[model samples]
Target: MPAASAAHAVPPGRTRLITRPFRARRIRRALFCPQILVLGLIASAGAAPMARAQDAAVKEAPARSSVAAEIRAQVGGKLRDFYGPRGFWPVWVEKDAVGPQADALLKLIDSAEADGLKPGNYDPKGLRRAIEDADGSGDPKALARAELALSKSFAKLVADMRAPSRAVKMRYLDPEVEPRDPGPADILRAAAVTSSFEDYVEKAGWMSPFYMQLRKARADYGKTWADLPDVAVPTGLKLKPGAKGPGVGALRERLGLSPGGGYDKALAAKVKAFQGDHGLTPDGIAGPQTVTALNRGPKYYARALALNMERTRLLPGPWVRHVVVDAASARLWYYSGGKLDGTMKVVVGAKESQTPMMAGMIRYATLNPYWNVPPDLVERKIAPKILDGASLQKMNYEALSDWSANPQKLNQSSIDWQAVASGRQELRVRELPGRSNSMGRMKFMFPNDLGIYLHDTPSRDLFGKPARQFSNGCVRLEDAPRLGKWFFGKTLTTDSDTPEQHRPLPQPVPVYLTYLTAASGKDGVAFRPDVYGRD
Candidate 1:
C-alpha cells in the first residue's frame, strides 16, 4: 500500500483536468489554423526548407511547438501528467538527436527477458525504428514520437520490475500479500527528475540486492541451458560409477560434460550436482526420475527462472533484519544486519491449502497458544468425525459461541452436528492448549488478514522429510523456541498455564513469506516443484 506521505501527493485527476483540455485546445488551434497549419505541413513535408527556416527564425521553434501539440493530443492520463507540466518538452530528445538515455532505455528493454519480462511487450523493435527515424531526419514530429515511445517503454519496464504483472497476480498472488504497484505518474515523475536518466533506468531506488542476485542467476542458467539440445537418457536405464552404456553418454551430454567420458567419478559427481539442484537425491546415480528431470531441459528451466525472477521482484526490499520463508522449498531464513543468521526446515501448506506469498511485521509471540481451527476444517473434517461418534473432549476440541473476548462456550451435545457437517451451520472450534494441541507450545504472530502465522507443531516428523508441505496454509516451524531466541536474544517462556499468552517483541521484525520455485545458490538456481501450482 502507498504510505501516508503518498496520499499527500497531488492526484492525477486534478492535474489532468487542469492541463489536458488546455493542451487539447492549443493542439487543435495549432492544427486547424490555416497559416500555422501550412507552416507545420511545410516543416513535416520538407517541401520548402527556405520558407520553413524563415518561419522557424521568426517564431523561434514553431516546429517543435507544433510537434509538442501532436504529442499532447496523442497521449493522456499519466503520460499527459508527465509531459504537460514540463511544457510538453521532449525528455529523450535533445538538440535534434536522441539522447544517451534513449539508447540505455532500449538496451534495458532488450534485456528485459533476463528479468523474467517479455521484451516484446515493450516493443523494442518499434522503439528502435522510432529512434532511428528521429535521429535521421531531426524532424520535430519524429523526435516527439520517439521521445513519447521511450517514456512509454520506460514506464512499462518500471511497472513490471516494481511488481508482478496482472497475469502473474491472477495465477500466484494473494490479494492480502500483493506488492503495491507504483502509479504511472509516480514512476515517470521519479525518472523525469533524475539527473541521469540512463542511471535511473538501470539502477533505480527499487532494485535491491536480492533482485540483482536472482537476475544474475537467471542470466547464468539461461546461458547454460538456452542452447543445449533437449536430450533424454534412455528410459529405465540406470547409470552408476563403473557402468558403461549409451545412457551414460546421454547423461554426460545433458549435463554439458564431455561426450567421451564414461560413468566415472567426475560424471557421477556432475550427476549428483544436477540431482541436488533439481531437488532429487544426490546419490551420484542417474536413475529414471533423474533422467526424466534432465529431459525437461532448457525450456522448462528457462521458464522457471523467469517466473522466479518475477517473484523476487515482488518481495520486500533489502532489510537489515527479517525472516523470509521460501514456501516452494519449505525453508526459512532469518537475517540480521543483512546477513543470514540462521535457516531451518519448515512445513508449509499442502497443495490444496497453499501457504500464500505475503509479508508483515512479527510484532509478538504467543506462549502456550490455542489452535483455533479454521471454519472450513470445522465443517469439512471435524464435524463429520464428531457426527460419527468421535468424542470432542478426547480430541481436545472446544466449541466457542463467538470470537468475541468474553464469549460463552457452546454445549457440544446441543449443537446440530449434521448441519455443521453438511455446511449449513458453522462453529468456532478451537483445540485446547496442551501437549496434544496442534499449535505446539508457542506461535509467532504477524497480524495479517489471512490469519497466517508461524508456529510450532506437535508432528515434528514432517520436518525431516524432503518435501514438507503438510499444513493448512499456516507455516509450522521446526523450532519455534529457537526462532523466539533469535528475536529476543533469550529463550521465551511462560510459567503461567494461560493459553494464548501474547508477549510483545522488543522490536518488530519484518517477515516476508515468499514463494520461489527456483532459488539461487553455489550450485546455481535450484529448481523446486511448484507444489501449489503457483509457478
Candidate 2:
C-alpha cells in the first residue's frame, strides 16, 4: 500500500480531485442494497444485458459429427471433460447466429481487466473472429473448436477470479486456513448445468458481493486515473505551516488552496488530514515524503486497488456473520446478518511480527484471561529482566511448572534465570489476571495453532494513533466489551479473580483476518501504508 497519491490533491481554488470525483457515496450505498437493485444498476450501465432464460427460444440439440468428436478429444483438460458428456456439438452457435450466451460471455471477456484479469488471456478478439467464421461457414469442426474455446476461456476466467496463482498465494500467505477454490473441472460442470449461462457470465452471480464491490472499486479507480488532469506537485519541495516560497505555493495549489497565499493554518490542517488518510504522520507538515506521495498520480492508486481486489478474492464467498480485521488499515469491520453492523480501530501485528491473514470461527470468550507470555518475549525481554534481579511479582508475572489445568507455581529463586535468558531452558511464564494485566479483562478465543486471537489490551491509548501496528501477531480490540455485547447479544461481566474462565458464545462467528492496503469507502479508495510490506 503506497501512500495515497496526489490523485486527490487539486490546484488551489479547484475542487479536490480526491475528495470530489472519488467520493463514491452512491457506490457504497449500492454495495449493501438488494441483489436485484445491483443487477439493475449493472443493466443500466450497459455492462450486463438482461438475459432471461425463459424468453430465449429453445432450439433442438445439435447433432455431433465424428470430426467434431475427434477435435473435442484432441482439446483435452476441463474443456474435453465438459464436452465429452454432451458430445462435441456447438453450445454457443445456433444455425447461422451466435447465441445470446456467447455474446454475453465475449462482452465479459472484453471487460475482464476491470476484475483484475488480463483481457488478452481470454483472447476476446480471436474468440469473436472464430465465432463469426463458425457462424458463417457452418463448419462442424469450426463450431466445435469455437465451443471449446469459449468454454476454455470462461473456465480460465472463473479459475483466475476464484483464486490467485500459487505465486500470489505465497505472497498473501494464510497457511492454516485454506480458502475453498473450486477446480476448473467443477466450475465447468456447474456452469454447464446452469439454467442461464448468459446470466452467470454477465451478472457473475457466482461471485460474492464483497468481491464484486472491489471489482467495481477497481473500475472506479481506473476511471479516476483516466479522467485525472496532468497535475503534479513540485518534486522535493517541503513546506511548514509558516513557510513562504514558490514551493509552498505549488503545494497549496496541489492541495486545492489559494495560489498566492503562503502556507497558512488552513493549509496545514488540510495537509494533516491528507497525511492521516494516507497513513503518514499527521503533524500538518508537508515533507519530502508527503510530496513524493502526492506526486504519485492516480494511476498508481488504480493498480493498488486492483491488487487489493485480487487479495480479497480468497476470502469466504458469502458469509452471513463475520468479523473482518484488516491489518493494512488497522481496522475491524463487524458484520452481523450479512450487513456491516459496526466498525472500530484495532492494533495489529507490527512489521517484526506480521499478523497473518486467516479465517477461524470464534467459539468462546475468556473472562479475566491470563496473558501467557510468548516464549520469544520471555527469552528476549522478561528473562533478561529477571536475570537482572527483577522479581516476577514486581512484573505481575507467575512462573508455572507446566501449562495444564492445575499446574504448580514455580519458585522464582529456584529457577535458573541465566539458563532461561540464554535460550538453553524453556519456561512457562504468564501475567496474572488484574487491572494491570496485558490482556485487559477478557479475550476472544478462536483456537488457532498460530496462537493469534482478538483480545482486550491494557494500552488503550495506542488506538488514538493514526496507525496502530504495535502487537505480537495478535489483534488488540479497542472496545472488547462493545464487541462482546454484539457477539453474545448481551453485556458480558465477571468479577472473579480466577483466570481461564470460559464462556461459550450463543453461536460461533466466523472471523476473517485479511490485509487490504487499499479499501473502498464513501471517500472512494483510501490507500494505507503496507506496514508488513506484503504489497
Candidate 3:
C-alpha cells in the first residue's frame, strides 16, 4: 500500500521519494543535507581561483622587468668598454647614442662592410669603384678614401687595446696616519734628503761654484723650512746679519737648507732653467705654472714616458725618416737616421679647433690644388657674404649658378646682383685654383673627415702667431711647400711643368700626430704645457 501510494505521489519527470523507517529516513536526510552544504561551499570558493591567477600574473611581471633592465645594462657596459680608453670611438658613440645623424653613419658603416671593405683589408681603388656603382652618384672616390682611413684608424685602436698597463694608482696620505707633528729632521728625511749639500758637492758631478754655493744655501736652510712653497727659499741657516750678498743666501734661508746644503738651490735653478727652455716667463719665483712644470704627478709623467716609448717603437727600422709633429708640445721634430736632427716651434690648432691625434700614410701631394671651401665655411661665412653683395669678385669667388636648384629653369641671369643682395635669392661661390686659394699652393692629402689635412693657407701671417686657430677645420702648415717637396721626393726647384700625380715612395712612411702632456728626454721626463688644454 505504501509503495503504491509513493508511486501515485510521484509527479511526471520527478524522482519518487522512497518511504522507509523513521530512523532510516532521518539518516538519509542528514547525509543529503551535508552533501548539499559541501557543494554550496565549493561554489562560494570559485571566486578565489581568479585571485590566484592574478597573483601568478603579478609575479611574472617582475621577472620580465628584470630581464629588460639586464639588457640595457649590458648595452651600456659594452659602449663604455669600447669608447673609454682609446677615445677613437667618440664620433661613432656620439652618433649612435645621440644626434639625428646616427642613421646616416649606421648606413655608411653597413655599406662599407657589405662591400667587403674590412678593417685591415682596405682596397681604396676597388672600394671607390664599388661605391660609385652602388650609389650611381656622388664622389665615391672621396667617400671610399674616408672609409679606408676610418678603418685603418680603428685597427690602430684595436692594436692599442693590447698595450701594457702604464697607469699608476695614487694613494692619498691620511693626516691621522702621517706624523701629527714631524720634526725638522723628519720632514727633511720625508722629502727624500740623502746627504748635506757639501757632501753632494764633494761626491756629485762637476758643478759650478755658484751652483755649489746655491746648494749650500739650500742645505743650510733645510732645517727650518716648512712646506716647500714652490718659490719660497728655505729657512734656518742663519747668515751673518750684515752680509749683503746674492739673493742666494736669502733664498737658502727661505728653503730651509739642510746639512751639506746645495740641494734646494740646485732644484730652484733647475726649475728656472726649465721655465726658460719652455718659453715661459722665467721669474725665478715658483708659481703655480712653475710648480706644475717641476712636479708633474707621477701618473702624468708615466703616461708621457710610455707614449714616447711607443713612438720610438713604432719608428721604421731604417735610415729613412720624416718630420714628426708632437701636437701637444706645439713642436715639430725632424727625424733622420733614427735621430732627432732638428726641432722647431709650431702654431698648432687652438683648444676649440683641436688638431686630431691620428696616424696615416701620406698618399699624395697636390700642388696648386683648388681649394673647395669646406661646406661648413660655405654655409656660415660665404653665404652671408653673397647675400650682402660683399664683392665676391674681389675675393676671387666664382659664382657657380649651374649647381643651383633651378639653374636652367629659373632666370638666374635676370636676378639683379644689387637687388639680390637685399635678401632676394640664394647664391654659391667657389674659389678657383690659384695662389690666392685658401689651400695656398699645396695640400698633403691623407683624407679624414675630422676635416683634418695638412694644407697651405692664404693667410700666411697667421702662422707667425703664438696660437693658430684661424681655419674652419683644416690644419694649415707654415712650410707647406717644404713638406710637399719632402713627401714627393722632389726638390723645391721643381717646376710647375712637373706632372701632377702621386709618386709612391719605395716604402710608405707612417705619420703619427699625437697629443701628450709630457715627453721623456735624456735628463728625465719633461712636462709640456697643455697648449690645447685638452685635459
Candidate 4:
C-alpha cells in the first residue's frame, strides 16, 4: 500500500513519479514484507501525473526500432525472450522514473551478495541512474533503455534464484533435474501487487536450507575475514602445537591473533576448528595443506561456497532414505529420516578419469562379482603384457563375450593380442572373483549408463591418504564390511567358484553422486577441494 500519511497528489486514474521521499528501510521492508502488491501510483514532490505521460510514450513503442533490437542492446537477447512477447513493454518504470517496486528490486540486487551473487551482474546502479536521468527528459529513447534494463535484471534474478542456471552444464549430469521457474509476467505482475518485496523473495523460495547455510557462511566470513592480510606460509612447513617460530607466528596471525611467536592451546583449538571446516585431519597442527587453507581470504571462500551452493541446488533431497557420495570430499553418507545413518571414507575418480556426478537408485547387490575390465584399461595395462606371452591365468583374467558372468574362455593362441590392443578385434576381459580381485568381494549395483558403481578394493592402504582420488570412475568404499552389513543385514562372504549373484534390495535407496566443495552440517560449514575444477 502507498504510505497512508502522504497526500493523494495524483488523480485516482493516474500514475505517479518516484520523487516522493521514502525512508530507505521502509522502502526495502515494503518490497519484501507484502507478498502481493496494490499497484498504486507513487507520487513525486513536483512531477506531473506519470501514467498519463507514460501512455503517450507506450503507444509510440511500435513506431521505433523492433522491440528485440531496442531492448536486446541494453538487456541481453536471451533474457529479452520473456518480456519481448508482451511487445517489449516496460515493467519497472512509471512513465520515465522507476517506481517503488523497482526500488525494492534494486535493493534486492544489492543484497543478493548474501547469496554470493554479484549485484553488478544485474546492473542495478546503472539502471537506477538511467531511470532518474530519463525522468524529466520526456525522451522515449532513454526511458525505453531504462525499462529494458530493469526487466532484464528482474528476469535473470528470478531465473537464477529458482536455479543456478549458470551451473547447469552437460558435464554435471547429476544436477539433471531442473527447478521450476515462474513465468516472467507472473513475477513482474506479482511485484506490482505484492505486499512486501521481502515476502516475495521468501515466497519465491528457490534456495534450499543448504544454500542458505553456505550463504550464511559467506556473510559471516565477509564480516570478519574479508579484509585481513593474507598469510604467506611456505609450502611443506609443518608446525605442531607448542612449536615456536616464524610458522607459528604466521599461523597465529592467520587465525586473527595478535602476533605472538608462542603456539598456545587457544591457537591449537582455532587451528583444529579451521582444519575441521576445510576437511583436513584436524590434528591442531599447521601442515602445508592446512596452512594453505588458512591463508585463503573470504573472497575465495565466498566464491567456492557459492559454486558449491549451486551444486547443492542441483541435487534433489530432503530425502527420506538415500546415499550421497561427495566426490570432491571423497566421503559417502547414508541418510534416513533426514539424519545420517552411516558414513564412510571413499576413494573417488582421479583427475584424469574424474568421477561423474549423477543420480540413480541402488538396484541390487552383486555377490562374488566378476570384474568386467573396461576396454580402455585392458588396452592400457593388460594388452602389452599378454602380447609378450604373459600367462592370462596367472593374471586372474578370462576372455568373455560380454559383461555377463558366464563366458567360455578364449584360447590364448587363437587370440591376436596385438589386434585386440589396437581395437581391430573387440575383446571383453573379465577378472574372476578372488581375494586379490580388483572389485573386492562384492559390488553394489546402480542403474546408470556411466558404468559406475560402489565396490571394495584391495588397496585399503590408499584410504589412509588425505586426498584419495585413486579410482578410475567407480567409488571404492573404505569400510565395505560395514556397508554390506547395512545394506543386506548380514556379513559379505565369498565362496570359491561361485557364480555372480544379484539380490534386489527390500526397497530401492536413492543415490546422489555430487561434487560439492562446500556445505553445512552438524559440523557447521565445511569445504573440500574442487578436485574437478568445477568451481
Candidate 5:
C-alpha cells in the first residue's frame, strides 16, 4: 500500500516513471527553457565582442586620418616656406658670396642633378661630395658648390619627413644656427667685390695684405701729423700739401738721424730707404702712389686682405695649387706648392666684353678649335669688316650659313654692318677649323654659354708687349702649350690621341678662367695697367 502511494506521488525532481501526457509536457518545458536561457547567454557574450570591435575600428580610422593629415600639412608647409616672401637663407648667402662662390654653388647643384641624383629624394651625402669635388675655395666656383650642397641638404631633410617613421618635428629648430640674415655691409662688400671694375682694382697691388699694412701705417701717421719730427727738405724735394709731418719724423728716426737738421739732406736718406722697401719712386718727395699707401687704414687693409682671400675662393684648390695666371697682374706664375714654377704674360678681355668672373672644370682640350666669334664682336667689330671686303680678307673672315649657325641665323650682308658696329647688329661669324684659326694651336673649353675660354694665339708676339689686350674677348695664354701639357700631362703628347690615352687620373681637373684685378706681393702692392680698359 505504501509503495503504490509513493509511485502515485512521485515528485518532478526525482521522478523514475511518468504518464505520456506528463512526459510530453515536461519535454516541451525543457526545450523551451534551454532556448530562452542559452539565447540570453549568447546575446550577452556577443554584446561585449561587438562593442570592442566597433571601438577598435573607430580608433583606427582616426589614427590613419590623422597621419594622412599631418603629412599633407608638413608638405604644404615646406612648399610655402620655400617660396615665401621672407626668402631663404641660402639664397641670401649666395647673394653675399657673389662671383666664384655663387657660381660654384649653382654649378654643383646643376651638375649633381645632371649626374642622376633625384630632385625629390636628394642625397645629402651626394651633395656634400659634389661640394668637396668642386671646391672653388680660392676659386669662384667654390661658392656655387657650397650653395648647391646646402640646398640639397634642405631638400633631403624635407624628403625624410615624408616617411611616417622618419618624420621630424622641425618647429623648434634654432634660428641663429640657421643661415644668417645678411646686412647692408655684407651686400655692399659683395657688390664691391663682384664689380667688373673692382676686378681691376684688385689686380693692382693696392689691395694686397702688405699694401694694406703700409696703408694703415700711413693713416696713423696722417692722424698725428703735427707730432711728426721735422727733417730738412732735400734739394729738388717737392713737398705736397697735407703731407704727414710725423711720418717724416718717424722715417728720420728709423734711419738713426736727428730731426730739424738740414731738411733736404736728412729727408733724402729716409725717402730712399722707404722707396726701396715700398717699390716706389726714390725721389725724396711723396707722390700720389706713395701718399696713397700712407693714407690706407686698417679697414682698407682688411678689405684688401679679404679681397685677396676672396680671389683665392675662385680657384680649384688642389688642381690650381700651381697655377700661374694673375688676372690682376696681367701676368701668370706657375707655382708647385709654394714655390715658383714658371711665369708668363697674358691677354685678357676688352672693356665692353669684359671677361666674366666664374669658376669651373676644364672638360676638354682642343688641339685646333674653331673660332666661334661672339655676337658682341660681330656687332662691334666684325660687322664693319664684312662691309669692307678688303678688311674681311685680311682678317681671314668667313660667313656661317643660316642653318649651320648656332642660336640664330646671321647674315652679314643683311645687317647694317656699319651701323651695327655701334652695338646694334646681332650677327655672328665663326672661323672654320684650320691652322689660321684665331684659337691658334689649342683651346681649353669649360662649356659655358658665356662663350668664354682660354686658348693659344697666332699673335704670340703680343705677350711681349707691356699691355696685352688684343683678343676679341677670350684670354690668350703666352705658354698655352705648356699649360695644356700641365693639365693633360702625357695625354697632351705631340702625337694625336684622345685625352684618355695618357695617364689615368682618378678625377677630372677643373679650370676656372676668372677676371680679377688685385693680388698680394712681398714689397706691398704692385699696380698693373688695365689693358682691357675694364677699370
Candidate 6:
C-alpha cells in the first residue's frame, strides 16, 4: 500500500508512488487517533452486586459510597468499562485503605523505568501517604479521596502506556496497520471481571517478548546511563592489527572483555561484531562511528529498548515467513520459520521524503526492471528539459502511454512532451533499464497505497554511510541478488539485454516496514539512531 496521501510529490528519477486520496478519505480521524474516556457508576465493586446496589439510594441500604459518587463524577465511565461492575458497589476501595488493587498499581508505577517513566511522575508519594494513614479508621471522606486518587492514577498509568506512541501518527500512510492504544477500558474490564488481580493482569498484560527483553536489558544491565562506565572513543583513534593505542585499552575496559585485551585479531573480531550490532559498517576499522556506538551508555540503550518495545507493539501480527525492513536502523532482515535467515544493509526514506511505514505481502519481483519516472518530477524537473529539445535517446528516455507495474512503451518523440512536462497534461516518462537507470537491476513488488517496494539501487556507495536514509520513500536493498534468489527460488541476472522478467514467489512472504531503532540480540540489546525522529 502506498502512503495514502491527499497528493504525493514524486522526486526525480525514482519509481513513483501515487496518492490514494479517495481511499484515504473513507476513514475518519479516530481510526488512528485515540481519545480518553473516563466514567463509572457503582456503589462498591468490592461489596454487594453492582446492579442490586444500583436501585438503592446513596443514603439507603448498600448505599452509594463517597468514592463511587466521586469516581462516577470523574472516571466512572472508563472505570466501569474496564473493571466491570459485577453488581458490586465501589470499584477501587476495599477495607477502607488502599487495597490489593491499589498496592499492585503503586509498585508498577514505582518501577516504571523499564517503560521510560518515573515513579514520582505517577504520584507514588501521594499514594504511599494515603496507604500509611489508613489505620482501622473507616473515615468515608479520607477513604473516598484516596479512592478518587487511585482512579486518577489508574487512568494516568494506562494513558502513559498509550502515550508517546498513540500520539505518533504514521498510520495515515497505512490503514491496514498495528493496533495501538492498549485499550485501558478493555484491559481493566478483564481485570475486574477476573477472579483475582493476577488473572486480570495476565489477561490485560501489555508487555510482549520485545517488551520483556527491554525490561531484561534494564535489569541485567544498570537502570540509568550513569550506572555504566563510559566507552569513550577519543577523536582520531584507530586500532588495526599490529597497531596499539590507549584507545584500544579503553575499548577493552568499555566492553569488559578482560583487563589486558589489546588490539589483537580476537579483539578486532569483537570490534567488528560490535560495529554490526550498532548498525555501523563492520569493516573492523575502529572508525569514529564505532566509537559513537561504543559510547552509547545504558540510559540511551534502555530508552531504545523501551521505545522499540512500543514500536514492536505497532506491528499488526507475526508471520512464518517475514521480511522486515527497519528504516530507523537502515537494515533489512529476512526471517524464515520465525528465525532470522539473513540480513542486508538498506537505504530508507530521506529525512524530508521519509520511507513509509507499511505492512503487506510480497507477491512477486521483476528482473532488470525499468525505472518509471515519478509524475511530480516529470512536471518539475524533466518537462522543461524535454521542451528544450532534449534528445530522449541521449537522456535514456522513452514515453509510456499507460501506467502499471509493467508499463507498455511508446515513441518518446511522438508525444507532446511540453504539455506533460509542464504539468498541463499527464504523460508517463520512463527510463529504460541501463547503467543510468535509478533502480539498479531488480525490484521486489508489493501492492499498497504508498507504493513502497524493496528494490536494488544504482547508488550502492550510499550503503557504506553510517546513517543511510537516502530514498524518496521506498527501501533500497544492498544485496538484491541474494534476496532475489531467495524470493524466486532460482537464479536471475542483469547481464542479459532483454525485456523485464517477472518472477513470482512460490510462497508469499509477509513484509513489514517497521521503525524499531532498538532490538535484542544474542550479545545484548542493540540501539540505533532515531533517524525518523520517532523517538
Whole-model lDDT per candidate? 0.71, 0.67, 0.40, 0.64, 0.42, 0.59
**lDDT of model 2 at residue 269?**
85
Cα deviation of 373, candidate 6, in Å: 1.1
Q: Per-residue alpha-carbon lDDT of model 6 for 1-535, expressed as tens digits? A: 1322101100000011121122111111111111100002242232456554333222222222444454455445555664334322344454233455565677677667756677677787886665555424545555555665665676566556545365344442323233434354544433343334432232223333344465665465453233546667576776676666677777766655664656877778877766665556678777777777777664676566655777665432111345778888788877542235789999999888888776666778887777777788788778788778787778988877788766677776677776776678887888888776788888888777766789888887899998899887988899998998877667766556785777777766667787877776555556666777877
Q: Backbone clash tally for model 2?
A: 2
Q: Give candidate 4's whole-model lDDT.
A: 0.64
Window of ten residues with lowest summed lDDT in model 5: 5-14
lDDT of model 4, residue 169: 49
Regarding TM-score, does 3 or 5 come out ahead? 5
Q: Backbone clashes per model, in order? A: 0, 2, 28, 15, 41, 32
Give lDDT tens digits, candidate 1, residues 203-243.
43344445667787778766656676678778888789988
Strongest candidate by TM-score = 1
Q: Which sections of candidate 2 miss by over 4 Å?
A: 1-112, 117-160, 165-167, 170-177, 181-210, 226-235, 239-287, 294-302, 387-389, 403-406
Per lDDT, what order, best first? 1, 2, 4, 6, 5, 3
Query: Which window of ten consecutive residues has the lowest lDDT sum in model 3?
Result: 6-15
All models, RMSD in angstroms: 13.2, 11.9, 34.5, 14.2, 31.0, 15.0
What lDDT does candidate 6 reach at residue 312? Answer: 61
Task: Name the better of 1 and 6 by lDDT.
Answer: 1
* lDDT over C-alpha atoms for residue 493 of model 4: 68
How close to the true structure is residue 11 of candidate 1, measured as C-alpha lDDT? 15
Give a tens-digit lDDT track for model 3, residues 126-152. 433433332342232333333233333
Instruction: Please write out the lDDT profile of model 4 over residues 391-487, one tens digit for every residue.
Output: 8889998886655536677867777889888977778888888888998878888767788999988888888898889889999999877887777
Models 1 onward score TM values of 0.61, 0.60, 0.43, 0.56, 0.46, 0.49
